[model samples]
Target: EDQVTQSPEALRLQEGESSSLNCSYTVSGLRGLFWYRQDPGKGPEFLFTLYSAGEEKEKERLKATLTKKESFLHITAPKPEDSATYLCAGREKGGGNKLTFGTGTQLKVEL
Candidate 1:
């Protein structure tokens, strides 16, 4: 079975503070790993897609990197507007777009 675990279920950061969230997983075979950001009561917004180990993607304050066993979402100098729930999902071989997701890491940026 495919499984995912996200650490530090919740994080509180002061504005301009930086941190990183982790997403660990085990799968039968990896099709892809994906990162997403979700606002309260909203659907997840796609952040990145990592197709293989050593792959990485970045945007703005977010940088996502992948390895065979895990992924990391690095947040650099976060701001109040950056507060949101970050989620990671894995697509196992033959799973298509149906992803096995880790419980999201909720981040609060206080100014």
Candidate 2:
């Protein structure tokens, strides 16, 4: 079975603080690693796609990296608007576009 797990269900950071969250997975074959940011009552907004070991993508204040078994999302100098649930999903071979997602790491950035 394909699965994804994220650590530290929630995090609180002050303005300008930076941190990284982890996502681990177990699957037959990894096709892609996806990162998304979701705010309250909103759907996830795509942030990145990391396809292979050592692959990485970055945008704004976030960076995402992938490996054979896991992926990481690093936040740099975040602001209050950066607060949201960060989700990590993976596509496994034969899974099609049906992504298996982690529970997500809820981030709170206080000014």
Q: lDDT of each prediction vs. the true structure?
A: 0.92, 0.91
| 18-87: candidate 2 lDDT, tens digit per residue | 9999999996677888888999999999889899899888888998988788999999999999999999
Worst 10 residues of 2 by lDDT: 90-99
Off by over 4 Å in 1: none
Off by over 4 Å in 2: none
TM-score of each: 0.96, 0.95
Query: Local error of candidate 2 at 77, Å?
Result: 0.7
Name the lDDT value of residue 22 in candidate 2.
Answer: 97
